[model samples]
Target: IELAEVVREVTKAENKPFKPMYDWGDRVEDKIFSVANKIYGAEAVDYTATAKKDLARIYELGFDKLPVCIAKTHKSLSDNPHLLGRPKDFLVTVREIIINSGAGFLVPLTGDIIRMPGLPAVPRATVIDIDDDGNIVGLE
Candidate 1:
């Protein structure tokens, strides 16, 4: 039943149009800020000012045409992960955009993305054990 539900969700998503968070524009910074204002009623600031010299150095090396990876919370469309289930009347605050020219992507630090995957309240490792007969036990 769980597998069926998962398949159903995958099918639904597959049929949906690919709507990007930010639209394409002459400047990536402008596009991001505009999209943020339109959708989340907030501003997207370019926190990359500190790395201006480094960025200029990279640009001079000629690796500017790379895709961006916006690092946002998967739990919610808004920056606040606590706002669940298609929340309305909310704002998304974009703090920074980190450019990884070598990796070929700009990581936009929106809200907070969990860089590390966390263990559940009661981790399965606690329950999972090897039986005396050498069979795995305690997993549904």
Candidate 2:
């Protein structure tokens, strides 16, 4: 069966809805601060020199109104991976801001987090099948 069909058969979802955490229309910097504070329990936000420059460029480009997606550590609520659980009284230092205008969102790189682009599992070369006559099937 297909994945969706299997999911439907295995679990009965209530289709319950939850409200959005913050309004997407809010300022990009405000959104970053809000996420750092509300979700991670950060006391304050400190932007690095590079991050400040990045933010300035973003604002100058009129991208300050864009939504923000903070890249932080997954091991903890805070930026540091060592601080597990709901950490509080910590400062979130934004290292840099990456503008993805096409995707319609700004990504703020927090702490020492490295931004890794999502890649597909199957390589295109693996799909290139050949028959006994040596005719390629998926070269395109």
Candidate 3:
């Protein structure tokens, strides 16, 4: 998607105006990449490799077979961590799986999931201080 955006920008600057190039069609890849960027660096290791390591580690712990719980964004293949800024392409892959008995769900520890959350402009915290004389004052 970033590549496509670049192509579009280049075309516009050159007075060509290309429709834009998309591998998976539309801007899905771009959106996914954006999310991953927010969670991890653009050059972070592949998710598949991470997943495989997790599976091996879990198996070594004496856990039997379990369901697979993908931690990536269900909306897209990539995780959602980056903000609105453009993101680079980072391939994602799965490695292993484990069952979470406590939660009654399969915990498939994938490479990683970068979750960038939205915050309120105004924080909901107030600071107050009191002196030995019992004089209270507001803190900023």
CA RMSD of each candidate after superposition:
9.0, 6.7, 13.4
| Top lDDT prediction, candidate number | 2
Tens-place lDDT digits, model 3, residues 98-137: 4565664344433455445556686534446787999876
| Superior by lDDT: candidate 2 or candidate 3 | 2
Q: Per-residue lDDT tens digits of candidate 2, residues 1-140? A: 69999787656674557566677777666788888888889999999999999988998999888888888988888888999877898989899999999999899998789878667798788888998998989978
Ranking by lDDT: 2, 1, 3
**Candidate 2: regions farther than 4 A off:** 1-25, 118-123, 126-140
Score residue 3 of candidate 1 by CA lDDT. Answer: 100
Looking at model 2, report the run of 10 residues with the lowest lDDT sum.
9-18
Tell me which of candidates 1 and 2 scores higher on TM-score: 2
Q: TM-score for model 1?
A: 0.44
Better of 1 and 3 by lDDT: 1
lDDT scores in order: 0.62, 0.85, 0.48
- The 10-residue segment of model 3 with minimum total lDDT is 20-29
Identify the candidate with maximal TM-score: 2
